[model samples]
Target: MKSKDNFEAVLFDCDGVLVDSEPLTLGTLRDMLAEHGWSMPLAECTRLFLGRMVRSQSALIEAHTGQPLTDAWMHAFYARRDAALHAHLQAMPGALAAVQAAHAATSGRIACASGADRGKVELQLHKVSLMPWFEGRIFSGHELPASKPAPDVYLAAAAHLQRAPERCLVIEDTTVGVTAGKAAGATVWALCSQGDADAQHALRECGADAVFGSMLELPGLLTPPR
Candidate 1:
């Protein structure tokens, strides 16, 4: 396992880590999928799409809906998802405090590396008033050649911060994201904010260097930037 001390930067996953927007996004997706004749519970929808890019599931979506996952359909999903987020998205409890702590400990060397589209990530951050902390430091996997589970996004964020991936601390909320951070050679901490014991076990099994149950616990876990 990688040591957590003397990290040069903190790289955060945007969805479940910073913003409490997963349910809103997944609810919209579940509704839209139902409209397309592929009805499923939000839990199932989340199980299928959380921590991964939506479009990457095109094959399964197409097979279930008996329709092509076209660009227009994606745009429609984006529109609906954004509206729902704008209306109800909130920052995860204690996220602001954690971000402030990260900023101070890392000396402002922090970035939001997200698996979602740039537009969607930006919109959610803005809606929840987190845009100021992330702004130009946000790296969207959708803008890269690959997204989560591929390590491209975290690698890009670490590169932009001029830090070695191994010297960065990655905070993620899902196994797919933890996999990506580990693949990028970073020390990853999984946020198990919902107190899900199974999720904590899964995250540890997926190679998270540590697991935390709240953003409130983050500051204590970090050391001064290298």
Candidate 2:
């Protein structure tokens, strides 16, 4: 594998990569579904929700249940989930250190690209004290025409950073995110924070350049020359 030499910026995906909020989000969704007489297994919930935005996830649920997920349902779900997230979210292991190291190494060129809305991303980052590392550097799929599995979000993040697509590196934890990054012409490093072996293998098959179990291993991949 050839080492990357000209990567001037690092882009991150928020939910699984920066904060370990997937479990909370998935649990909240399951609980909400249960209120409507729908019960989803934890594994199935995780598979369905991983890397997908709330609106899209709701659409999927609508398709499955033959019931329209109305705006009221979405609003209520987000209100409850946001509160839970505020109370429980935490930075993923080594995530803060990795962001800091990357920022220091690149002179403040690290950015986050998330499937979450801007407010939710900001709130979680602030709660975990990781907001400062991303000052003025967060982009959301809400601002794009499409979310993960499409190149819009990553492409927007690259454009916001004023870096060429090939000059950026994307850190992602889902197959959809990896595909998006590659589609945007960025190299991807997949983190196995949410899924199992099969999922990790699928991410690589989709387009990840490498995969790691934790962000602690990222520094070596970005180690600067002496």
Q: Point out where model 2 deviates above 4 Å.
A: 1-3, 224-226
Question: Each candidate's lDDT (Cα)?
Answer: 0.91, 0.86
Candidate 2 to truth, TM: 0.94
Q: Write the per-residue lDDT of candidate 1 for residues 1-226, one digit (tens) a residue.
A: 2334878899999999999989999999999999999999999999999987888999999999999999999999998888888888899988998898889878999999999988988888888788899889999898899888999999999999999999999999999999999999999999998788898999999999998888877877774344
Considering summed lDDT, which 10 consecutive residues are worst modelled in model 1? 217-226
Candidate 2 local lDDT, 14-69, one digit each (tens): 98899988889889988988778678898888777778886776667876667789
TM-score for candidate 1: 0.95
How do all models score by TM-score? 0.95, 0.94
Off by over 4 Å in 1: 1-4, 223-226
Best candidate per lDDT, number? Answer: 1
Query: C-alpha displacement of 148 in model 2, angstroms?
Result: 1.3
